[model samples]
Every structure is written in structure tokens, then in C-alpha cells.
Target: MPSRYVIVGGGIVGLATAHRILQDLPDADVTVLEKETAVGTHQTGHNSGVIHAGVYYKPGSLKALLCKAGSRSMADFCAEHGIPVKVCGKLIVATEEAELGRLRELYERSVANGLEVKLLDGPAAREFEPHVAALQAMHVASTGITDFAQVCRVLAELLVKGGAQVRLGTRVTGIRADRVLTDRGEIPYDTLVNCAGLHADRVARLAGADPQVRIVPFRGEYYELKPQRRDLVNGLIYPVPDPQFPFLGVHFTAMIDGNVHAGPNAVLAFKREGYRWRNVSIRDLAESAGYRGMWKLGRKHWRYGLDEMRRSLSPKRFAASLARLVPEVTLADLTPSGAGVRAQAIRPDGSLVDDFLIVRHGRQVHVLNAPSPAATSSLEIAKHIVAQLSA
Candidate 1:
């Protein structure tokens, strides 16, 4: 008899995993259980939709390897499925002399990751993006943009066509060694994959794995450039990210829809799905506040934390940060847009996880942390997970 596999999340990763399983093991029974009424309602849907190149990741790490391979896979998948994707590329700019060193470091990392990158002086950078202000920049040819939500939808359709089961609004409440107990009923399976994004740690515990990481939701708030000012950003314009923090800092992204997005200031959200400060959950907030990891992180970066909060609450401050990249971008040119909460995994020692974290226990595999590039690397990540199962 074919093995029965149950997937616990319906995000891009879970759907991609199901698609790969059915493609590789034709007779295997695959069922995807999602708590939301629809797929991609969380991170998959709320993200900036930038198809990342193999940039900024450590050399030879899972993120670097998967991102390089996955970007190519994603472009092919999009082309095959009639989904719209633009390889518009990106520029990492340094406005001040102090930032040049970090910019050079990122350029080196990009080269080490085997990506096609070019160093651009201020004049060269402005030649590519007329409105951009920079002393120097790294032009990454591989970076692109697409609607990941559409990708998830296409993956879901493919899974259904391939005879995989996708159960929406089905929340998994508990997990046993060989069975998954859910809100609807109990599901018996030979294998279980946890791709739960926001609550991955909780789900891992349910499956009896000590993942040793806590999911800390960091809300990234965005603003949209007014239609008339959209031309100010030709493509994506990013600052040299602070090596001390995991976030990419405030940047301008030319989304696939033609509107430009700016300023995703990172702040601690009060809830796992919290998009706004007012949307608070006592339980989620308590868990995050009570975690030793959260406290440690806060103590180390309290100043940065306060600044992020200030940007969250003040539109002028947020736009001011964006002005560092594009001097033409004024506070009046921006309108508040959507926000996404990143499911960052924090270790007990207060350090943020910098790579993808996946662990397996007998018949179960849990994805503990997969932020940023996970959506871009979904297909490759799926392949890696399937390979683990085969082993």
C-alpha cells in the first residue's frame, strides 16, 4: 500500500510539498490541512513579493543554496503556468560613506553565492534609477518580483488536478506519532509534514519534537507611493542592511502591479497575525513577552526596537527613512498600505535564526523557521523535504 502523508499547513511551502509528493509518488495519499478559509492568507499573501536572488545569505548555507536553485525553478514554474513574473532586478544602495563597507561586504557575499552582481558608483546607480541617491550600489541582476499569492493558487490547483486532497478551514488541534487530531476529525497517516508558518513551534511540540526555537512575529509595515510618483522607483531600491539585524531595512519595491511599495519598518506585533497595533491577542502577546528569547532580544536591541515602533506610529518618520534611498520620496508621496508579520525564529540565547530550520522525528518533519526567501525557495525546499523523507 502507498504511504499516507498529512501536511499541517496550507501556505506556499505546504502546497509545494504536497505538489512534489504527488508528482514523485503517484500513489501516495496526500492531504493538506489548513486552518484558514483559504490558502496564503498569512505570510504568503502579505509579503513584499520580491523573488529574491541568492543575496545576503551566508556562503554555502541552505538559504544560499536553495535560493539560487529555487529562483531558477520559480521562473520556470511561473512561465509554465502562465503566471506573470518580472526579472526587473534590484539595487542595494549606500548613501553615506559609513555604509560603503557593508555594501562592499554584501557585494562580496553575492559573488560568493555565485550570483551575477555589479558594483555601481553614484552616477551609475542614478543611470539605472534616476531618482535614487547613492554613493555606491550593488546591482543584482537576478532579483525579480511576482505575485506569490498567485503562485500558491496555481500550486493548489495543480495539487487538486493531480488527485491530492486540500482541506481548507481544517485546523489541526493535536498530533500523535501516527495520527493528526483536528477540529473536524482525526487523520491517520504514515508521515506528517509541518509547514505551519506562524505556529510552527507549537505544532512541533504537538508532534513531540523539541525544536528549541520560538516563533516571534515581527510586523513589517508598508506604504504605497502615490501613482504619480511611482516612476521615481524604476525597480527595487534597498539600503545596505544592518548586519546586526536580520531585516533588510526600509526600501522601495516596484511591485508587479505597477504600484511601488516603501517602508516596511519592523516592529514587534502584539499577536501572531497582528497586522495593526490595535489588533492584539492576549495569549499570543503573553507568549512572546514571556519567552526568554524575546526578552534577551529586546534587552540587546531596545534602542532599535523603540525606533521601529516610532516609525510604525509616525508616517513622517517612516517616509524619512525611505528618503535615504530615494531623495524624491517625500512623506506626502506615501500612503499607508498593507503589512506582513514575519514568523522569525528566536533562540533562547536571544539571537534571531538566520537560516531555514527544518527538523524530522521518525514519521514527522517540522519547519521551524522559514522567513523571507522561503516563498521564493518553496519548490527547492519541498524537494529537500521530500528527499529527507525518502532517506
Candidate 2:
């Protein structure tokens, strides 16, 4: 008899993991349980769609390893599926003297991370990005853009073709090692994999596994440039970033569709899935407030949290942050865009989990936290999960 496997969450992580399992175990009966009406409706769909270049992660970390490998894998998948992607590259520009040192360090780290990068001074940087104002910059040629939602669709299609079942609109209410209870009914499975992006901790708990971390949702709001100003950014343009905050800071990104986007200010959302300021859930609010890990995080990152909240409400303030990267951008040329909520894992001591934390029980695995580079690293992450399961 084939081994029955149940996967929680229909985001990129779950779908990718299911696809990987079928690829490895040809006869495995894999069933994916998604809480939403469709796949990739949450984090995977809301992302900025930038292909990460493995520049920011520390050397030899899982994040670095996965990001580097997954980026190439994602691009390959796109090529095979007729999806278009542009490797237009990215510039980590440094406007001030103090930022120049960090820019150089990033360049070195890119080399160590096995990425193609170059360090450029003022005039040299201007040659590539004429509108950018920087004393120095690190040009990462591997960074690019693609529609991850489309990628998810392709992944689902591949899974179905491989004889795996994807159960969309079936919200998993409870999960155990051998049985998964959903809104529709119950499913019998020998193994369960939890890839619930936002509710991973809760899903693990439902499976009778105690994950000591809590997911603190951080909303990232963006601005799309006016059609006339689309030419402002040829590729991705980023700031040096503040070391205090986990965010990559407000920057400009050229989408694969030819439109330009800017200013994804990171802020804590009142609700776990809150995409708009008016959308609020009392249960979500109370759950976040009641978590001991959140209390610890609040105490540590109160200032950064407040700043992000201010930017979330005030478009003018958000525009100013984007202006720091591109001087030509103004308040009028910017318009409100979609928001993405990051499922950040918080420790009891108020420290943010900077690494990709994967917890495994006998026949189950839980992805507790996979933040920014997750989309770029989804395939490599899937391979790693398969390796873990096989081991």
C-alpha cells in the first residue's frame, strides 16, 4: 500500500512540498489541505515577486543555501512552463559615506554566497542607474522578478499531473499524526507536513506538537508608480537598510509586467491576514496581544514597530522613504498598492528568528518561519524537506 501523506496549507510551501514528495515517492498518496478557497491566496500571492539573490543572508546558513539553489530552480521551472522572468539585476545603493562600508561588506558577502556581484562607485553606479544617487553600491546581477502566483499555479498543475490530490477550499480545523480533520471531513494519513505560512505554530500545536515559537504578522505595504514614471527604475533598486529592523527598507522594484513598484514599509498588522487598515478581527487582535512571545517582541521592537505603523497610515511618509532611493519620485507619482503579511517567528526572549526554522517530529515537519527569501527559495526548500524526510 502507498503511504498516505497530508499537507497543511496551500501556499507555495505546502504545494511545493507536496510536489517534491510525489517526485521522490512515486506512489505516495499526497493530499494538500488549504484553508482558503484557492491556493497562494495569502503570503505567496501577496509578495513583491522579486527573485532574491542570496545577498543578505549570512554565509553557510540554510537561507543562503536554499535561496541560491531555489532561485535557479525557480527560473528553470519558469522556463519549462513558458512563464516569463527578467534577470534585470538589483542595486544596493549607498547614499552616505557611512553606508559605503556596509555596501562593500554586502558585496563581499555576495561573493561568499556564490553570487555574481560587482562593487561600483558613484559614476559607475550612475552608468547603470542614472537616476540613482549613491556614493557606492553593490550590483547583484542575479536578482530578478517573476510572478510567484503563476508559479504556484504551475506547481499545482504539476502535482495534479503527478497523481497528487490538492484539496482547495478545505480548511484544516485540526490535525494529528494519523488523521487530519477538516471542514469537509477527516482524512487518514501516515504522515503530516505543516507549511501553514502564517499559522504554522498553531498548526503544529493542532498536530499535538508543541512549537515554542509564535508567528507575529508583519504587514508590508507597497506603492506602484504611475504609468508615466514606470521608466524610473530599470531593475531593482534598494537602500543600504537599517541594521535595527528586519525589513529590507523601502526601495524601488520593477515588476515583470513592466510596471514599477516602490515603498514596502514593514508594519505589524492588527489581524493575522489584515491587508487593509479597515480590515480587523477581534480574535486575531486578541490572539496576537495575548502571546507571551509578542509581549517580549513588543518590549524590544516598540520603536521600530511604531515607525512602521506611522508609515502604513501616512502615504506621504511612505513616499518620503521611497524618495530616499530615487530622487525623482514624488508623492503624486505614487499610488497605493497591495500588502503582504510576513509570518515572522518570535522567540520567548523577544528576538526575531533570523533563520529558516524547521521542526520535525517522527513523521511530521513544521516550517515555523520563512520570511522574505522564502519565495525565491521555495524549490530548494522543497528539496531540503524531501531530504529530511528521506533521512
Candidate 3:
């Protein structure tokens, strides 16, 4: 008999894994369980949709390897399916003099990762982006943008066509040695893969595994430039990340739809799926607040958190932060856009699990943390996860 494969989560990674399973084990019975009414309803759908070009990751890391290969594969996948994608590239600008050193370090790392990049000075940067204000910049030519949600939709379609089951509105309630107990019923399987983004850690514990990490959600708030003000950015523009604090600061992205998204300032969410300040959850908040790692992270970055909160509350402040990269930007040109909650994993020491964290427990595989570039690397991530089933 063919093996019965079950995947928890309908995000891109889960769907992609299901897709890979059909490719490798054509006769295997495959089923995907997504709690949401549709696929990619969460992290896969709610993102700026930038196709990362393997920049900023440590050399020879899983993130670097997968991202480098995934960017190319992602762009190709979109082209094959007729999904719109743009290889418009991006600029990592140094607006402050103190950032020049970091900019150079980033450029070197980009080269070490085998990416083709060019370092440009302030005046040279303007040749590519007329309004950008920078002391120096590194031009990463392979960065692009697309709608990742659309990619998920195509993956789901392919899975169904390949004779794999795609079940929506099915939430996993419990897991046992041989079957998955869900809201709908039970799914017996030979293998289980966890791509549960926000609730991945919880799902692992439900299956009797100690992941040694906690899922802490951080809300990335964003705004868009008014259509008339869209000329401010030609493509993607980022800052030399602040080493003193976590996260890549606010940047401008010219999305595939011609809308420029800006200002995804990171702040801890009170709830796991919270997109706005008012969307709080008592349970999620209690879990996060009570986590020892959360307290340690807060203690180390309390000042930065306060600043992010202020920026989150005030559009003027957020625009001021954006103005560092594009001097022409002003508060008047800004309008509210959507927000995305990132499921970042932190250990007991408060250090983030920077790489892709996947651990196997008997017949189960759990993805503990997959941050920023996960969308770009979903296809490759799926391959890596499927490889584990054989080991």
C-alpha cells in the first residue's frame, strides 16, 4: 500500500510540500489540512511580496542556499503559470554616515553568497532612483516582487489536479501515534508535516515534542504612497539594518500591481494573528507575556520597542523614518495599507532561531520558525522537508 501523507497548514510551504509529495510518491495518499477557509490566508498572503535575492543572510547558511536557488525558481514558476512578476531589483541605501561600514559589509556578504551586486555612492544611486537620498548604496539586481498568495493558489490547484486532497476549514485538535484528530474528523497518515506558521510551536507540543522555542508574533505595520506620489520609488529600497535593534527598518517596495508599499515597522503583536493594536487576544497575550524568552527579548530591546510603538501610532513619525531613504517623501503622501504578523521563534536565551528550524518527532515534522525569506524560499523549503521523511 502507498504511504498516507498528511500536512498541517495550507500556507505556501505546506502546499508546496504536498505538491512535492505527489511528484516523488505519485501513488501516496496526500491530504492538506488548513483551518482557514482558503489557502494562503495568513502569512503567505499577507506580505509585501518581495522575491528576495539571497542578500543579508549569512554565507553558506540554509537561508542563503535556498534563497539563492529559490529566487530563480520562484520567478520561473510565476512565468510558467502566467502569474505576474517583476525583476526590478533593489537598493540597500545608507542615509547616515555611520551606516557606510555596514553597507560595505553587506556588499561583501552578497558577493560571498555568489550574487552579482554593485556598490554605488549617493550621486550614483540617484542615477537609478532620482529621489533616493543616500550616502552610499549597494545595488542588488536580482531582487523582484510578486503576489505570493497567487503562487499559493496555483500550488493548491496543482495539488488537486495531481490527485492530492486539499481540505479547508479543518483544524487539528489532537495528534496521536497514527492519526490526526481534527475539527472535521480524523486523518490517518504515515507521515505528518507541520507548516503551521503562527501556531507551529503549539502544534509540535500537541504531538509530544519539545521544540525548545517559542513563537512570538511581531506585527509589521505598513503604509502606501498615494498614486500620484508613487514616482518616489522605481523599485525596492531598504536601509542598512540597525545592529543595535532587530528587524530591517522601514523600506519602500514597488509591488507587482504598481502600488508602492512602505513602512513595515516591526512591533510585538499582543495576539498571534493580530494585525492592528485593537485586535488583541487574551490567550495569545498571556502565552507570550508569560514566556521567559519574551521577557528577555523585551528587556534587551525595550527602548527600540517604544520607538516602534510611537511610529506605529503616528503616520508623521513613520513618514519621517521613510524620509531617510527618500527625501521627497512626506506625511501627506502616505496612506494606510495592510499589516502582516510574522511568527518569529525565540529560544530560552532570547536569541532568535535565525535559520529554518525543522525537527522530526516520530512520524511528524515541525517547522519551528521560518521568517522573512520563507515566501521566497517556499518551494525549496518544501523539498528540504520532504527529504526528511526518507531519513
Candidate 4:
């Protein structure tokens, strides 16, 4: 019998890993378990769709290194597979004098990451993004956008073509040493990979791996531009991020469909998979509220957390934040959009894991955290995970 590998979760990471494994070992029996009826239903589908330019990560960090390579690879893959991807470029604008210093720092980091970038003054920035207000900005010419759902579908297609089985609506309830207990039945496997996005820690624990870290789901809420207002944004427009916070501030993105989206304030979700304001699960809420990491994060960034909550509940407030970037945007030009849950890993020390966190335990590997650039870096992250696997 061929060696079996069972991977939990069917997001981009899981699909990417399955694809890589089959490519590397064609005879291996691979199975992907997704609780959702379809792939990319969570973060991957609701994401801003920006192909990050690796400007914010620390030099030599896994995120920076992989994002640079993965973004290019993602573009290439999309092109070869006939997926729609637009390399429309992005701008990190410094709207106020206080942000100028940070803008310069991002520019330096972008150069260190070996990406092509140009510095633009306020007027120069306006030349490209006429609606954006900024004193200075860094134009990352390589940043772009794509429909990751399409990418996930292609990945599934490729996996099927390579003879791998993806089992949807199959929830892995537990992971024993040599078997995965699922809602349908037990899957016997020699190797198990945990790519569970919002519940990575739980999956690792189920696999008998003691992951010291915990998965904290942060909800990022967005607003879409009205049909009349889509023309205001030509591409991606971002703010000079606050260095202290892990969440990127509200920004504008010209999606592949030519509509613009803005705001994704990072607020702690009451439920892991909660998107709408009224949706809640008591089990999910207790799980989050009881975690020691949750309190630690709250104690550290209570103010930012409160602000995120305020914005999430009030569209007018969210619109105000977006107006800072595009002065012409009015309350009427905005409408409620879907929210994405970010699986942020909070360490025991109360610090957010900004970089990709990967842990190895016996025959199993767990992805603790893979943030914003993750979608852009899926291919490279897959390669890294495969390389880390002990043969």
C-alpha cells in the first residue's frame, strides 16, 4: 500500500501543500479534509485580494523572504493556469507629517526585500491615485490583486489531476498517532499535516502535539465601493501602518472585478467563524474569552481593540476612516461587505506572531499562524513546509 498523508483544512495552504506533496511523491496517497462544503470559504475567499509587496515585514524574516518569492510565483501560476491576476501596483501613503518617518522606514524595508519601489511626493502620489491624500508615499510597483477563490479551485483541479482526494464537508474531529477521526469515518494515514487556519492549535492538540501557542481569530470587516465610486481607486492604496500594531490600517483595494473595497479593522471576534454582527456561538465565544492569550492581548491593546469594535458596528465610522484615504468618499458611497477572520497566533508572552509560525511535532506539522501576506505567499509557504518535513 502507498504511504498516506492526511491534511486538515482546504484553504490555499492546505491545497498548496497537497499539490506539492503529490508533485514530489506521485505515488503517495494524499487526502485533504475541509469542514466547509467548499474550499476558500473563510479567510481566503473574504480576503482583500492584494498581492502583498513584502514592504512591512522585517528583513530576512520568513514572511518577507517567502512573500517576495511567493507573490511572483502566484502571478506566474495564475497566468499559466489562465486565472485572472492584475499587477496593478500599490501605494503606501503617508497622509500626515507623523507618518512620514514610518513611510521612509517602509521604503527602506521594501528595498532590503529586493523589490522594485519608487518614492512619491504628495503631488506625485496624487498623479497616480488622484483621490488619495498623502504628503509622501512608497509606490510598490509590483503589488497586485487576484481572485484567490479561483486559485483554490485551480489547486483542487490540479490535485485531482495528480490523483489526490479532497474530501469536503468532512470534519476531522481528532488526530491519533496513525489515524484521523472524522465526521464521516477514520482515515488511516502515515503522516498528518495540520493546516487548520482558525483552529490550528486545536488540530495540533488533537494530533497529540502540544502547541504552546493558541489561535486567536481576529475579524476584519470591510466595505465595498458603490458602482459610482469604483473609479476613485485605480489600484491598491494603503496607509503607512502603525508600527506597534499587527493589523494593517484601513486601505483601499481595486479588486479583480474592478470594484474597490476598504477597511478591515482587526477586532477580536466573539466567535471563531463569526462574520455578521448577530452571529455567535457560545462554544466559540467561551473558547476565545477563556483563553489566557485573549486577556493578554486585551490588556496590551485595549484602545485599538475598542476602536476596531466601534468601526465594525458602525459603517459611518468605518466610512470616516476610509475618507482619510479618499476624501471624496461619502457615507452613501459605502455598503456593508463580508468579513474575513484572521487566524492570529498570540504567544504566551502576549505578543502577536506577525511572522509565519510553523511547528514540527513527530510526524505532524502545524501552521500556527500565517497572516496577510500568506495568500500571496501560499506557493512558497508550501515549499517551505515540504522542505521542513522530515523525510
Candidate 5:
């Protein structure tokens, strides 16, 4: 009998892993468990849809190493599979002279990561994005955009075709040495993989793995350009990195769907799956408020947290932030749009995990932290996780 491979979570990462397992060991019996009625209902479904080219990551990090390769593979896979994809490129703009140094650093880092980049002055930057404001910018030409949710569907279809089971609405409750206990019943498996994005840490602990990290949800809110104002952004317009902050400041993105998405200020989510302030959970709040990591993070970045919350509640503030990238944008041009909750892994020390965190425990593997580039790097991440399995 073939080894039964059971994967928890049906997001892009989970589905991609299932596809990889079948490719590596074609005879393996694979199963994917998703709590949602359909796949990609969370993080994979709600995102900026920018295919990153590893421009912003620190050199030699998993994100930097995998992103360039992932971009290539993702675009290739999308094209071969008949998915709509475009290499529209992006600009990391430094609106003020003080941010110029950071833009140069990002350019050098992009080069170190084996990517082609160009440093543009205000005039050259305007040549690319005529409506933008910039003292200087780093233009990353290989950045692209596509629908990651659709990618998940293709992976699911391919998995079923390979004699695998894609089970929906199956919530994992516990994990024994050789099986996963779900809301429905028990699922026996030879090996298990946890790609539970928001609940990854909990899932790890359920399987008796001391992941040493806690999953903290940060909700990123967005506003889209009104139909008449969509022309303000040409491609992805990002901000220069500010080392003092935990997140990159909000900017504009020209999504594949032709909507210009702007302003994603990160604020702590009361619920792990919270998309709005009203979507609260008493249980989720108790766990987060009770965690030492959450308290430590608040103590450390309380001011920034307040600022994020303030911005979240004010559309004018969001527009001001976006106006730094494209001066033509205004509060009147904005329209309410969707949001995505980032499953940021916070260590007990109050530090956020900056790279991919994959842990192996006997027959189980848990992904504790995978942030922004995750969607862009799902294919490569799947391969890396599966490569760790013992033959």
C-alpha cells in the first residue's frame, strides 16, 4: 500500500504541496483538508496579487533566494496552464530625499539576489509612471501580477487528476502520531503536513511540536481607485523600506484585474481570521491578549500600533499615504475595497519571523511563518517542504 499523505489547509501553499508530493512519489495517496467550503478562501484569496521579483528581501534569506526563482516558475506555470499573468514591473519610490539611501540599498540587494534593476531619478521615474511623485526610485522590471486564488484551483484539479482527494470543510481538531482528528472524525495518514496559515502555531502544538512561535494576525486594509481614477497607477508602486517600521508603508498596486489597489495599513486583528473591526471573536481575543508575545509587541511598538489603527479608521490618512506615491490620488478618488489578514509569526521574544519557518517532527511538518512573498513563492516553498521528507 502507498503512503497516505494528508495535508491540512487548502490555500495555495497546501494545494501546491499536495501537487508536489504526487510529482515526487506518484504512487502516494494524497489528501487535502480545508475548513472552507472552497479552496483559497483566506490569505490566498485576498492579496495584492503582485508577483514579486525578490527586490525588497535581504540577500541570502529564504525570501530573497526563492522569490526570483518562484517568479519565473509561477509565470511559467500560469502561462502553461492558461492562467492570466503579466510581468508589469514595479517602482520602489522614495518620495523624499531622506529615503533615497534606502532605495539605493534595495537596488543593491536586488542585484545581490541576481535580479535586474535600475535606479531612476524623478524624471526617469515619471517616464515610467507619469502620475507619480518621487525624488528617486528603484525600478524592478521582472515584477508581475496574477490571481493566486485561481492557481489554487488549478493545483486542486491537478491533484484530483493524480488520484488525490481534495476534501473541503474538514476542520482539523487534533493530531496523533499517524492520523489527524477532524471535526468530522479521524483521518489516518502515514505523514502529515500543516499549512494552516492563521492557525499554524496552534496546529503545530496540537501535533506535539514546540514551534517556539505564535501566530499573530495583522489585518491589512485597502482602498481601490475609483474607475475614473484608476489611471493614476501604471504598475505596482511601492515605498522605500523604513528599517524602523515592522511593515512597508502603504502604496499603490495596479492589479491584474485592472483595479488600482492602495493603502494597506497593518493593524492587529482581534480575531485570527478577522477582516474587519466588527469581526471579533472573544476566544481569539483571549488567546492573543493572554499571549506574552502580544503584550511584548504592544510594549515595543505601541506608538506604531496606534498609528496603524488611526490610519485604519481614517480614509483621508490612507489617501495621504498613497498620495506620496501618486500625487494625483485624493480621498475623493478612493473606494472601499477588501482586506487581508497576515498570519505573522511572532516569537515569544516579541520579534516577528522574517523568513520561512518550516519545522519537521517525525511524520509531521508545520509551516509557522510565511509572509508577503508566500503567494509569489508557493511553488518553490512546496518543493522545499517536500524535499525534507525522508525517503
Candidate 6:
């Protein structure tokens, strides 16, 4: 009998996995189970859509390896599908002397990762991004942008064409030894893959796997520049991120849709899918608050958390943070856009997971942590996961 594969979640990673399986094992029976009615409704659809150049990841890590390969693969896939993508590059700048050292470190790391990068003094940086306030900058030529939702759509189409099943609105209620119990009914499977973004940990537990990491949802809030002020950004403008924090600070992104976005301040969400402060879940809040990891993290970064909360509540504060990179931007030029919740995995000791984390139990594989570049690295992540399954 042919192998029966069941994948939970319909985000980019899940769809990409199904596409990869069909490409390699044509006769395999693949069924994707998604609780939502549509694919890419969460992180994949809510991201900044930047094709990362492997700049911020540690060299030799899965993120670095997959991101470099994924950027190229994603661009190729986009080209093959005729999906619009732009390799418009990015500038990581240092507006203050203190940030110059970190900027230099990122440049060195980028070089070590074999990426095409160039260091730029302030005036030279201005030539690339005229409005950027920079003491120094590193130009990453490989960074670009594309609509990931479109990519997910095309992947789903390909999966369907290849005779794979995409069962939308089907929620997996339980996982047994050789079958999946769903809200609809029980479905037998030879193998299972969990790509559940926000609730990966819960899904893993259902599959009888103890993935030590817990998923902590962090909401990133964004603002768009008014149409007239869009000229202030050329491509992508970023700050030399604080090495201690996982989030890259507020930056300017020239989206594929011809608009510029700024200031996705990372804040703790009251609910897993909470898009606004008013959207809360008592159960989710209690779970997060009760987690030892959460308390440890909060105690360590309470100051930073307060500042991010301020940015979430104050538009002027958000714009002022953006002003560090582009002085031309002001509160008046900003408008509320959208928000994306990052499913960050945290250990019991409070260290945030920094790479693509995958674990396997018996015939099941769980993607425990895949944030940020997961959208950019979806295709390559699928290749990695599939290769593991074959092994």
C-alpha cells in the first residue's frame, strides 16, 4: 500500500510540504488538515513579505542555511509561477556610534554566510537611500519582497493538481497511533507532520510528543506611510538590531504592492490570534501568565516590554521610533495598517528559540518553532523536512 501522509495546518510551510511530497513521491496519499477555511490566514499572510538574505542568523544554523537556499529557491519558484517578486535589496543602518559596532558585526556575519554585502559610510549610504539617517550601513543585495499569500495559493493549486487532498475547515481533535481523529471523523495515516503555527505545542502533545518548547505569541503591529510620504523609502531600510532581542527594530519595508510599511513593534498578545489589545482570551492569557518561561522572560525584559506596549498604544511613539532611521517620517505621516502574531518558542529557562526547530516522534514530525523568515524560507523548510522523512 502507498504511504498515507497527513499534514496539520495550511500555512505556507504545510502547503509547501504537501507540494514537496507530491513532487518526490507521486503515489503517496497526502491530506492537509486546516482548521481555518482558507490557507495562509495567519503568519504567512500577515508577514512583511521580505525575502530574507540570511543576514541576521548565526552562520551554520538551519536559519542561515535554509534562508540562503530558500531565498534563491523562492525567487526561482516565483519566476516559474509568474508571481511578481522584486529583489530590491535592503540597508541595515546605524544612526548612532554605539550601533556601528553591531552593524559591523552583522556585515561580517553576512560575509561569512557567503552573501553579497557591502559596507557603506553615511554619505555613501545616502546614495542608496537618500532619506536614511545613517552613520554607517550594510547593503544586503539579496533581500527582496513578494506576496506570500499568492505563493501559498499557487502551491495549493499545484498540490490539488498533483491529486493531493487539502481539507480546509477540518480540525484535528486527536492523534492516535496510526490515525487522526478530527471534528469530522477518524482518518488513518502512515505518517503525520504538524506545522500548526500558533498551537504547535498543543498539537505535538496530541501526537504523543514532548516538544519541550512552548509557543509564546508575540503580536507585531505595523503602520503604513501615507501615499505622499512613500517616496521617503527606496527599498528596505532597517536598523542594526539589538543582538539581545529576537525582533529587528522598526524599519521601512517597500512592499510589493507599491506602499511602504513601518514600525511593527513586538508586544505580548493576550490571545494567540489577538490582532488588537481589545481581542483577549482569558484562557490563553492564563496559560501564558502561568508559564515559568513567560515570567522569566518578562522579569528579564520588563523595561523593553513596557516600551513596546507604549508603541502599541501611542502612534506618536511608534513614528518617533521609526524616525531614528528615516528622519523625514513623522506621526502625521503614519496610519495603522495590520498586525501579525509570531509563534515564538521559549524554553523553560526563558531563552527564546533562535532557529528553525523540528522534532520527530515515531512517524510524526513537528515544526515547533518557525518565525520571521519562515514565510521566506517555506519551500526550503519543506525540502529539509521531507529529506528527514526519507532518511
Runs of candidate 1 with Cα error greater than 4 angstroms are none
Q: Which ten residues in a row have the lowest lDDT in candidate 2?
A: 241-250
Lowest summed lDDT window (length 10), candidate 4: 270-279
Clashing pairs in 1: none
Task: lDDT for model 5, please.
Answer: 0.90
Q: Score candidate 3 by lDDT.
A: 0.92
Please rank every candidate by lDDT, starting with the best. Answer: 6, 1, 3, 5, 4, 2
Tens digit of per-residue lDDT, candidate 4, span 1-391: 9889898989999999999999888999999999999998888988988888788899999999999998899999999999999898898888899999888888888899999999999899999998899889889988988999999999998999899999999998877889999999999988888998998889988888888888887888888999888989988888889888778899888899877888888887777887875768888788778878778878988998888888877888988898888899988998877888888888777788889988888888898898778899999998998898844
Give TM per candidate: 0.99, 0.98, 0.99, 0.98, 0.98, 0.99
Candidate 5 per-residue lDDT, tens place, 197-271, comes to 999988999999999998888999999999998877788889996665547789888888889889689998999
**Compared with the true structure, what per-residue lDDT tens digits does model 6 show for residues 1-391?**
9999999999999999999999999999999999999999999999889999999999999999999999999999999998999999999999999998898899999999999999999999999999999999999999989999999999999999999999999999999999999999988999999999999999999999999989989999999999999999999999999898889999999999998999688999999999889889998889899999999999999999999999888888998999999998999998899999999999999889999999878899999999988988999999999998988
Please say which candidate is ahead in TM-score: 1 or 3: 1
Clashes of each: 0, 0, 0, 0, 0, 0
Root-mean-square deviation per candidate: 0.7, 1.1, 0.9, 1.1, 1.0, 0.7
Which residue pairs does candidate 6 place in steric collision? none
Badly placed stretches (over 4 Å) of model 3 are 244-246
| Candidate 6: 10-residue stretch with minimal lDDT | 256-265
Off by over 4 Å in 6: none
For residue 20, what is the lDDT in candidate 2?
91
Candidate 4, residue 346: Cα displacement in angstroms equals 0.6
Predicted candidate 1 versus true structure: per-residue lDDT over 1-391, tens digit per residue: 8899999999999999999999899999999999999999899999988899989899999999999998889988998998989898999999999999999999999999999999999999998899899999999999989999999999999989888889999998999888999999999999999999999999999899998999999999999999999989899999999988879999999998898999688999999999999989999999999999999999999999999999898888898899989987899999989999999999999999999998988988899999989999999999999999999
